[model samples]
Target: MWGRVRKSWSTVRDAFRTERDTGRQARSHNLFEAAAAYVSACAEDDQERIEEAAGWVSPEALSFGVNELACRAVIALARERDESPRAVARDLLGLPAA
Candidate 1:
């Protein structure tokens, strides 16, 4: 399901963000995290907004976008599901989806 993709991307994005901005040393990896974030966010949002923004990012371009979007998507989904964001992320990430 979309949840897996969203979860994986969110994890990657968060990792990258922590490395890049949370006083770590993984700057190079941050770009990938940002890209994954973008994919997840774009997929979870309202269709109208996605459509409007779609034109701005080609599939190729999205590959290079920031993973922050994925972080955003998982957050949104967690809110919609009314459950623990970490639990949902773990489920989607294939960490025992209980």
Candidate 2:
């Protein structure tokens, strides 16, 4: 799963680079927009949308945005369930409790 993620990220990076080289206007999408679209696309398994969202920002920027989104999501879930963030994250991933 992670390997596929890396591959897709790299593909986006390459496409962005090509677009830059072509002197095209950069997308106006903010980090949050890219994050939301990317995550939703991933949830729906929409590769086209994922690539489109990825193009909205640099790979590193997109990564940071995604990380922020995940953190916020975990915090929200923890609050809703009255559980610790760590516990919620572990449960989300189906990991054994420590």
Candidate 3:
């Protein structure tokens, strides 16, 4: 009887684990989709929309930290452009840089 109970509990535990992992993966995928959409939308527009993108971002997934870092990365990639933070911050927000 004890052996049967243990097996049942083990099965339940594995099911719960699988459910949790699935939820996490789904959430990650959704976030990636949203971020990609945001980038695409922003890129299609002109520099005038840069400031607007800062609010379009999902603060929960990509915090201000990630945004700032990504901005710096862009600056690095544009080694010859000598872009300014304020000028590029809007594009860094996900919009196309001016």
Candidate 4:
């Protein structure tokens, strides 16, 4: 009987752990989505959308997301243009060409 009770408790504990991990993953995904929204707003030059996205996630998370998006964009543009990522980034920022 004690063995059965122990097994049941173990099952419940495993379920709770899974649920906790799932919740954490969902929250991280939601933050990333918010960051994507912020990046999209920046591309569109829409201040309203940017502000809305800022409200959805913490500033640090949003900043990290924005940086990640910028790096991805630079890499994609570099590949498409057959140029270095540095050149692509500099051009996007209107910096002097190297």
The global C-alpha lDDT for each of the candidates, from Candidate 1 onward, is: 0.58, 0.85, 0.50, 0.74
> Residues 1-98, candidate 2, lDDT per residue (tens digit)?
99999999998765334332237765366777889999999999999999988887788778888999999999999999999999999999999987
Ranking by TM-score: 2, 4, 1, 3
Candidate 2 backbone clash number? 0
Where is model 1 more than 4 Å wrong at Cα? Answer: 1-65
TM-score of each: 0.35, 0.73, 0.28, 0.64
Winning model by lDDT: 2
After superposition, candidate 4 runs with Cα above 4 Å error:
1-29
The digit string of per-residue lDDT tens for model 4 on 32-88 reads: 677789888888999998987776656666677678877888999999999999999
Which candidate achieves the best TM-score against the true structure?
2
Off by over 4 Å in 2: 1-27
What C-alpha lDDT, on a 0 to 100 scale, does residue 97 get in candidate 4?
92
After superposition on all CA atoms, how large is the RMSD of candidate 3?
12.1
Structural RMSD, model 4: 9.7
| lDDT for each residue of candidate 3 in 29-77, tens digit (9 for 90 to 100) | 2333334444655668644443333334344543443455466567775
**Residue 9 of candidate 1: its Cα lDDT?**
96
lDDT per residue (tens digit) for residues 12-95 in model 1: 655434332446743443444445544555668656555433334444444445445557767899999997888778978889
